[model samples]
Target: MPVRVVDSSAPSQVSGANPSHTSPPACTLLSVGQAFSGTQNVSSLQKDEAWRVNVRIQGCDLDHGYLCGTMEALNVPMADTPWVIQVVTFWEGEIVDMKNYTFFTGKWEATVGKPFPLMVVLSIVNRSEVDTRHWTKFPSFSPLLSQVEVDGGRSLDLSNYPYIFMRWKEQYFVNVGTDCGLTIAGFYYVCFSCSDGSINGFYYDPNSSPFQKLELKITNEGRSGFSFSSYELQ
Candidate 1:
């Protein structure tokens, strides 16, 4: 995903602090989003630096329909520089299967005058149906995730993490989502099962991955374990 530089005049805002801290930690869906602004006395050319930024994406400003990202740094020095402060805000309750997938993002801050200014960019990973137009579907598998775990541990929360799904385009496929490493590189190892039997799984994510294809070695064994293996871009 590519980040965008917003107008310094306006920035995004954050609302709805997660009291329960239940929002997925991956997207900071429940963390505080804050903005910063201060005039720096540029006595001499300063070296590159970083500043913590806040982006609040709402209906007013949206790139696609939602924003799912983490803190990123702008190369420009946060010291002795004039910058417009902004915060991109989004609804704190966006946690559902398909609806929570929409993200709207905008607003940014820019520092004036520098050898090579680098503004912290507001990057995006669009989950809108339109962006997934070219995705291919795979054979449907009813994986009974009774013994499956996510990343690690025994908890499987499909809302924030990737999971198995059945029947999308008359073919069965895995819903990797904008998450589950859509931009990740190499193969995806998926493990799941159905009531009829159990199966070992793997996925080969081609470039521009999405609606990823699934490969399952269907069998009636290995019913008490879960494992995840893959290589993702850093």
Candidate 2:
């Protein structure tokens, strides 16, 4: 697949989160992909309740799946938000909180020293079961990092921040309190603004603890636990 840079066109405000509770994820039909190795952990909420997640990909065939990238992790856990999707396109290594956007691929480009777009396919589930969600498309999105100044308009570098791990309390990882950063008056550029042009979920504090480390896991006898002993700075 040839890499192409997207134009300045704005992202179309589309629907998000499949509402059907029993439907399989969109990634299932991409390849002959079944649940490739997954890990389960006891929930921090219900003692008897457990959370299971899996990382599915087309192995060596990046050309096979609609959402082609290095990694695509998805799962349905009976939590506040029952469905979760994480996708990384060829150019962007990782996209945090992808569930927050209405679909905004037009925001990234290699011309700006960033990664280019790739063959994209999204079979996303609907409706977040969370009490408070960051899915608001426009005006309500957070702007925490978009306000930062870059030399000659460089694309944001997500590698410097910690990756979002759904295994934790979910809240602590994706939640950046409304007051965590500054918001430019007219620009509505705040610390947690989702206006980063990718998805509606880019708001964050760079130096914050939750954004400091990647998720670590250990597997044994069909169970995986957060490996607290392992953490590497992004």
Candidate 3:
């Protein structure tokens, strides 16, 4: 699916100070949301509802910037072959004021089974300042089957059970199982801070808006394995 951007501007509000000779704002290196694109197809095993996400960058000095995020659904039908669903980085738009900068946002969906789970990742970089800090939060996925492994010399039941793995920031990894699942389905608030080597700071505000809520569901798609049925964030 394509990338979507959300507008997060409120009544004129100010929070931080701007330094002399300010550099351009940071660029969004990556962003991934499970609730982007409304609803997406993952092979033919199962279908899942979409989640909602909103991202805002406040307290910075820059007029224009770039950002991108991607989400992938993995299905491992066999030890040697696997299926993947992915969304990558794309430009959202330009920023005019740091006090009221809300640029990136969207929703997405997917389908999966036992051998795989949903994975999301996001990354941002500030080019204007040597040091920077930003706050971000999105919905987390809970896997139906938590852990599995494949050995070359061992005989395994490949048809009855599948394996899944999710990686974020290329450092953290999560295993999906039958017990774990996403806990929420709404927007989260974050704070960002940046400065040259002489000055730097960061802040993150928890989501307090009344419109934030979570909804989740699981379905049996009648395939050889289980599948995600529906999900909504409103």
CA lDDT of every candidate: 0.22, 0.21, 0.20
lDDT of 1 by residue, 1-234 (tens): 111221112222322111322322233222123212222111213332223322211111111112222212223232235642322222112222222211121111111221111232222212112212211121321232221111111123333343322111101112212221112222222222223222222222223223332322322222221111221211
Tens digits of per-residue lDDT for model 3, 67-147:
212222222222233532222211122221222222122111111111111132122121111111121222110121111
Measured by TM-score, the strongest candidate is 2
Candidate 2 lDDT tens digits, 119-169: 323221111211012222234322322311111112232322222211110
Q: Which ten residues in a row have the lowest lDDT in candidate 2?
A: 182-191
Q: Rank order by TM-score, top first?
A: 2, 1, 3
Error of 1 at 143 (Å): 20
lDDT for model 3, on a 0 to 1 scale?
0.20
RMSD after CA superposition, every candidate: 21.5, 19.3, 22.7
Query: Which residues of candidate 1, in runs, are more than 4 Å off?
Result: 1-131, 134-213, 226-234
Clashes of 2: 17
TM-score of 1: 0.19
lDDT of 1: 0.22
- Which runs in model 3 stand beyond 4 Å of their true positions? 1-62, 73-234
